[model samples]
Target chain A: MSPEAQEFLHTFVSESFYYWASVFMLLIHAGFLAYEGGASRVKNVLATMVKNLITLASVGLAFFFFGWWVYNAFPLFPMAGPILGPWTNPEASEAIKAAMPYVEGSYPWSSALGPNNADHMTGVFFFAFALFAMTTASIMSGALIERVKIGAYVFLSIILGGFTWLVAAAWGWNYFGWLFAKMGYHDFGCSGILHATAAFFTLGVLLNLGPRVGKYDPQGKPRQIMPHNLPLTMVGLLLIFIGFYAFLAACVIFLPGYEGETTIYGTPVTLASIGVSTTLALAAGLVGAYISAKADPFYTISGGLAGIISAAGGMDIYHPAVVMLIAFVGAFLMPKVAMFVERMGVDDAVGAIAVHGWCGVFGAVVVGVAAGGFPQGEGIPAINLGTQILGVVLFAGLLGFLPGYGCSWVMKRFDLLRVSPEEEVAGLDLADLGVPGYPEYATYEYVNEQLPVAQSSGSTKYAE
Target chain B: MQFSPLLAIFNPSPFQTHSEFLEVEGPFYTFAHQPGMIAFLLILCALGSIYFVYASFFIKGEQAGLKSPLALSLLLALGLGAVAERVYQQTLRQSDRPTSAVTRGVQMRSPQAPSPRLKPLALLGLVGGSAAASRRRRSSASRQRRIR
Candidate 1:
């Protein structure tokens, strides 16, 4: 084939690859829609679904306007001058230079952001990243459902999706990122950068947002608020598991002329490795959750997500067996971590903090231990335990927790963070949406009778 | 020089680069450019729809003595209006043939030329009309029940 012909073919393939990946990533939102809806009591189902849907729209726009730019601009933030990667003089590459946030086309108003014949990769790539941003925002959505104000949630989603997690990505997930270059931070699938950051952020929000009114008894003992539809929730989880394949695939960069796949950090990797490890980790997580939670359907399905996250950071290099082991341990410990969070008086409607945050930290830290002394890239530090631990602390604390807590705290002070107690008890669907997810089922007298007696008692047993 | 009235109405050239002129581009290029605009416009429409949906809820919440912030709803509506105006202006500029000032001026002066200012007003009218119709239907239904 002519060189130009080959180049065109390569560009087409690369563009189509990310395009399909973005399409598959849409399933994650679909899953979240069902998952949260099923998890919510019937009164709150539509409210739950609305929040999930709104996360996609709000985060998507925010990512296009600023999130992509932040990823490009801040790789060397808090420092000046370019940090050299394998591609010496990174600015020499047109693609890299055009993508730089300081560059004209990378900005929102740039023609490159609009329609241009010369660019095939930017739009598709931007879409993939936008989906990632939406996913990050959605991670926090489930945790604050039922009681959260939609307006407040939108504000939080924009900051987390468009700004904070991207900061973590620029610092850790990029090839020239400071964390990667100086400290050998290796989060190939963004366990630390995306999942942990969002999870910790959710934790911060939950701290300020408080728990559901009937989540606990007067003795400070936790009461189980069962999902309205266990089967639907499990099915939703399975869809998320499917979408996760695309998530991992998007992490691998397929350069047109390059021989094999590479991590975002430019380390050699293979799609086969990612596929195998992810599947094994998923299976391990299910088994672990099933055994540990004693076949509790909710925790078992949640374990599947927790498992993938646990091994995601090191899946590029870890053997399938090692992936399984890590996944199992993470899944097994998930219920315990969730219980601990509950003990602290926080109400996480879904176990997002445990699944994403704790497991993401475990995945990231395990990479330092398991993949220690591995060379990251040319001129970058080798993977080690200390840097991984530091990455977790920094990602969870500064990037994740602080903004989450600070924003939510301000919202709380203004009484804007949560719905009114009356609104909460009456259900967000009727109070906020003026519609119910299951209008027919919601009106059934028997369903109301079946609800926990504690809900109708108006007891302040759990109130602080 | 004269431009097609259809060009003014459709505004198909918003994304076409200066070099490309009227030449049809490759499939991917055409597809890429087309969807980006469609998606943007669709998102704006969806946002507008969501705002109206929530606005009704906010009013209801206030009527129920809940502290719903009407200011936030107004801010969102204003933001959407500004974005819609910018998009409309960009489309108008692109659709106006670049070589002929006379054509641009003529199109600008034409009474049929679409105005960006009408978008928000049109949106409000549509939403308000639907809301009023629903209110009437509800009141009549309640009156019939009272009579029964």
Candidate 2:
């Protein structure tokens, strides 16, 4: 091919790849919708679906306005001084300069954030990151479903997605992030910055929201709250499994250099490694979860997720055996963690906390041990047990759990954290939306009667 | 590239009593063959096994003593995170090269693009409107029930 043709082709391919990555990330949301809907009771399915849809819309717009800017701008934020400066390379220095959120080249007001003759990839890149931000919000959404107020949900979603998650990305995921530059923090696939952040955020919300009605008996023995449609939930998980291909691919930083694709931290890796580690981890997780939970399908699918998360931090560097073994351990531990949390009275409707939170922390630890002493970035220290552990604790405890807890606590104080008990027993659909997801399958009286405390007598009278 | 763990299964010197497994290829066997990684995996396994056994057999459910320990552990984690972040900031400051936190934050807020403020307003409106409608519906339903 001619030189001009080759350049055009490269641009076309790069833009196309990013666009597709964003599209595939949408599948993650579809999966969450299906996953949450199936997990919800027949009455709350529509409500659950609405929450998922709103998160995409809210987080999408918010990300466009401020989220992307936050990621670029805050890499060395909440700290003083130039990071990795004294740069002789013009390109490198310019790239760093443009990262500031309010800068002319990168932020919302900048033409760079939009489609321009000079740039074709910026918008596409933003789309992918926006989707990631939305995904983090959706993870928290699932755990708080069926009980949370819409106002509270939307408020928290924006805080987590558009603000907190972006901030965490700035601190940890950014190449120039102080965590990477100074502390040698490494999270190849956002296991800590994204998944664990969301997981801990969800955990905090669950603590304040309280358990679903009849989740436990008077004796405190947990009762089973099975998914309304296990098949749908499984299918949703399958969609997520498919979407993960794009999610994992998006983590690669493809630049014009001797090495084409590298991690955000500038670490070179083969796509083959990611593929091998992810699949083996998934397989191991499935087996571990299946065996641990005595072959329950819900836990089995959850195990698959745990598997992916368990090895996510080291996917680029880990051997397949390491991936499998890590995932297996994570999968096995997740169910026990879930049961333990349930006993503690934090009723996570799905195993969101176990699969995302515990597994995320586990995955980062895998990287610390397995890939410890490996260089994470230029001029930074090697990955180590202390750094990895510190990242997990900070992301999961301070950045993740603290904000989630504080937000939900305020919402709870104002009675915005949960639906009224009457709404809970009658179902969110009848109470909130005045419409049932399935009128044919609706059994209002039976649902109300099963409640430990009957707040409403024969849920009746509705407005058009 | 066609990747496989065949080396793990088909070692050339199978007859040797003390053959090194470090020569294997593929993503799985290559890393597992490393001594440090092997030691890491073994330690993790041992710890995992003990924890699993203890959790399953001894700590059944609703133990009152668990709360204090969990709280204490979480507090320690928070303190450690705070310290680490502070240390990281210190390192960034003491370095010969410096990154400007103030300029970055300022530049981040003042994008060169024509970013309209209407989008955020619209988002707030959508969420606020839906919430109000739901609140009205619930109050109206309750009133209707009371009248009946």
Candidate 3:
């Protein structure tokens, strides 16, 4: 093949690969829909699914216009002269040049941002990041399911997906990020940046949004809010298990000339290592979570996700056995953390805090312990416990919590955050969407009337 | 990296269809080729395939345990892996070069760079779009309250 033709072919295949990754990642949204739908009361199922779907639309568009730019622009904070400079200077590494905002074609109007012959990877890369951004929004969506106002939650999704998470990505996940350079922060698969950030954001929103009605009693004790559809929830989790490969795949760079592919931070990594580590983590996590939860299927599957998140930070470097062990620890500890948070009066509907937030922190911290001497970026300091801990605090507490709380607080002030008590009792679907999830079953009054008086109580309705 | 006889199929070196594999040295290759690692990995793969064949031919419900799901999962995984391998062979043909060099001057040729000043405008647009939706919701909420 001619040199030009070879280049073109390379571009086409590379773009196609990233695009496929983005498409596969959409399954995660489908999983979230079923997971949230099954977890919620029947009256609120459609509303939950709609909220999750709307996030894809709103966040997808918003990220295209701005989130992509944020990632490119903010990699350098106090010093950013290199941005928009010529790419051939050869002074700093390619990783640094790639991180410069709009310099390497991240501007919305840049030809590299779209389908241009001159650029093959830009569109697909942006699409992948856009999907990642949407995921951050979706994570928060599940935790505040029943009572959050649709508009308010959607607004938060726009900000979290389009702005906050992208900023965190620029700071840590980007190759030329100051944090990587100065603090030696390392997160290969974005445990802290994506999972932890989204998880903590959900926690913050839950704190401000408050628990769903009937979630707790006046005695400060928590109640078990069983999922309305366990089968759907389990199947949804299975889909997420399938979709997570795409999420991790997007975290890698598949460039033409690189031997083993590099990470977003330009560290040498391989899809093989990712595949092996994630699978081991998932298996170990399932077993661990099952054991810890006394074989509760929901937490057992969630433990699989927790294991992936926990091992994600170190997967790029960890041995398969080590990955499994780390994941096992994370999964085993996950439910206990959820219990502690519940005891603290925070009713996280889906255990997002423990699964994503705490596990993400655990993942980051353990990477520090396990891979302390690993290099973060070219010429930068190696990974250390201090830097990893700092990254956790920064991602989960500072960026995740503060923006989440402040945004929801502002919405609360405007009375835009929560549905009123009346709306909560009537069900969000009936109150907001004007339809019930199961219209046929909506008329179970006659069936209830025929039941024995003891079994006909409101609390026993779902038991049947 | 300690050898896990079970996971040797994930070793990247054996599947180097692309020329770049020869040029670039992966970090894991340093420890991956420990004396008996390759033979151990091969044995594991052979054992696994043999077990799979046996399970498909003979195992029944109670005795089958997790064999069916495991087999199905492996088939799907191998299909996806094939797709990935095809893409890698087709695309990753060139030597290592920075992405900056490849897309240089393209942005300049297209249009003016987006100013940092425009970021807030995009955010404002999101807020405005969400605000319109909220306004309708708030109006409906008030109507519900009055009726109650």
The candidate maximizing lDDT is: 1
What's the lDDT for all of these models? 0.74, 0.71, 0.71
Tell me which residue pairs clash in candidate 3: A72-A101, A257-B95, A257-B96
The regions of model 2 sitting more than 4 angstroms off are: A80-103, A256-258, A442-464, B1-148
Point out the higher-scoring one by TM-score: 1 or 2.
Answer: 2
Best by DockQ: 2
lDDT of 2 at A175: 76
In terms of TM-score, which candidate is stronger, 1 or 3?
3
Q: Which runs of model 1 end up more than 4 angstroms from their true locations?
A: A80-104, A442-464, B1-148
In the order shown, the candidates' DockQ scores are 0.01, 0.04, 0.02
Interface RMSD of 3: 14.5
- Tens digit of lDDT per residue, candidate 3, span A1-464? 99988877777777887999899999889998899899988778899999989999889988877788877777766444343334435347655555543445776678787657666777788888888998889889889999999999889998889988888888888777777776778798788999999988888888889988998989987788888898998888877877788899878887765545777766667888788877888887886566555466678889999999998887777766557656876886677677767777888888889899989998987676555544444456666656788888988988899899999988988899999999998789888999878866733432454345536565565446
Assign candidate 1 its CAPRI class.
incorrect
